[model samples]
Target: MLAIGLEGSANKLGVGIIQHPDRSSLEHNKSVTIISNIRHTFHAPPGEGFLPKDTAKHHRTWVALLVAQAMEEAGVTVDDIACICYTKGPGMGAPLTSVAIAARTLATLWGKELVGVNHCVGHIEMGRAITKADNPVVLYVSGGNTQVIAYASQRYRIFGEALDIAVGNCLDRFARTLNIPNDPAPGYNIEQMAKKGRHLVELPYTVKGMDCSFAGILSSIDLHAERLHKDGKRWTDPETQQPITREDLCFSLQETVYAMLVEITERAMAHVGSQQVLIVGGVGSNERLQEMMGHMARDRGGSVFATDERFCIDNGIMIAHAGLLAYKTGFTTKLSDSTVTQRFRTDEVFIKWRD
Candidate 1:
């Protein structure tokens, strides 16, 4: 069976086609084949963040083109698709609604079933499918969400998360403060800069038991940047008294925040008595973060699993994979019930497909 997925939970709008082999052929390792996966992202100016209204407009405009492109790349027609999957929540309302509208339109026009997928669940499912990590502790870190999750009683239970702002949000906002380019991605640019930093500037590290907070760290860093800009003073390393560069700030932020995430994930793993760890979401693509997580897992006599940019960042394939799982389990969303939301929780979904 084939499934087409539309995803625009935030600035990125994606269209993907996936094929699931017949039940008899599912015994092989490659049961699922990705036909086509394409995406278009909306980039705001250096000091600006993408607004929901503008991001929605971008999705609405490019969704049709992307869908057509994906279909062509997949070498399939509308008649081949058995289901249409779209992200249903935990994102900006306007973007989610825009993508949902496109999905509904496609389903109605093609006379196919509609499947609603949770954005976070999509990430987790894709991570598992690609990494072959079975029931590992998952750390999902994105621009909007930061969570450590484990499966229990047919639910992906959240063990820890950010209390105030997400770690990606913290990095993006800090990038804006430094006027970093958002062409590829602010986080990627920050990661590159961090590699060149020699000294780590101390920043506030706030972790409340299991949950962590990044708002204080962002504020403190912003204040220091402002003071340096206003007074024209060169930030110096406390030990060597050498001038500190912007790279140092970016490096410090990544190190501090990623360490906090690794700490909480380790705690969750110890609590759940699990040895394997899976990292998902956009921030999961960071090499430094992955390195840190691998070190932590190795020390615990375990290993870490992660994917590259294709699956780590927001994309349609994850939604398609997850929604198809639900569709196979006799789940479908009626047209009347296919409304988009901005606060859907991961634990809210009943995992009927999992034992």
Candidate 2:
């Protein structure tokens, strides 16, 4: 069966097609195959964040073209597709609507069912499919959410999450302070700059129980950036009494934030009594965080599973895979109830596809 997925919950617009093997052909638990995955991002200028209005406009402009391209690449006719999938919630209101409208239109025009997928669940299912990380603790860190989740009783139960401000949001704002370009991504540029840094300046580390906080840390770091800004980017390191470089601040922020994530992820693993860890979402692609998570998992005689940028960031293939999983079990979103939302919780979804 073929599923076409649309995802435009943020600055990026993506469309993909995935094929599910016939039940009799399935082997070794593998289920879905990516037929095509194409994406386009609306990049804000340097030192700026993308606004919802502009992002939604970008999506509306590109959604049709991306769908066409995805279809061409997948080599499938409308008749070959069994369903249409789209991200329905837990994202920017306007962007989510833009994509959902496209999904609804296509499903109506093609006479196919519509599968509305939870954004977080899309990431989890994609991670599981790619890494085969069965029943691992999930560390889902993205621009909007920071959550440690575990599957139980047909639900992805949240064990921990950010109290305020996601880790990726913190990084993006910090990149703005340094006027980093958002072409590839502000976070990606920051990660690159962080590699050149030698000093790890002190920053507030907030971890309470299983949940963590990044708002306070962002404020404190912003102040440090302000000080440097006033001095024309010439500030001294407080701990070493040496010149503070942009790279130093980038390095410091990543270390502090990633350490907190690793800590909470470890706690979740222990709480769930799981030895496997799976990292998902855009921020989960960070190499340093992956390394830190690897060290933590290894020390506990476990391992960390992570995907490259293809699966790490927001994309439609994940939506298709997840949506298809549900669609196979007779799940379909009614057209009248296909409206998008900005605050859908991950735990709300009932995982009927998993045993």
lDDT of each candidate versus the true structure: 0.91, 0.91
TM-score of 1: 0.97
Whole-structure CA lDDT of model 2: 0.91
Q: Give a tens-digit lDDT track for model 1, residues 1-355.
A: 8899999999999898888885323321247788898999999999788999999999999999999999999999989998999999999999999999999999999999999999999999889888889779999999999999999998999999999999999999999998899878999999999998777788899989889999999999897677567756457656667777788788889999999999999999999999999999999999999999999999999999999999999999989988888888789999999999999999999988787
Please list the residue runs of candidate 2 whose C-alpha ends up more than 4 Å from where it truly belongs after superposition: 23-29
When summed lDDT is taken over every stretch of 10 residues in candidate 2, the lowest stretch is: 22-31
Candidate number of the best TM-score: 2
Specify the poorest-scoring 10-residue window by lDDT in model 1.
22-31
- Spell out the clash pairs found in candidate 2: none
Q: What is the C-alpha RMSD of each candidate to the true structure, in Å?
A: 1.7, 1.3
Model 2, 1-355: lDDT tens per residue? 8889899889988898988885333331376688999999999999999999999999999999999999998898999998999999899999999999999999888899999999999999999989988889999999999999999999999999999999999999989988889979889999999999888888999999999999999898888888787887668876789888788889999999999999999998898899999999999999999999999999999999999999899999999988888887778999999988899999999998776
Q: After superposition, how far is residue 147 of candidate 2 from its true place, in Å?
A: 0.1
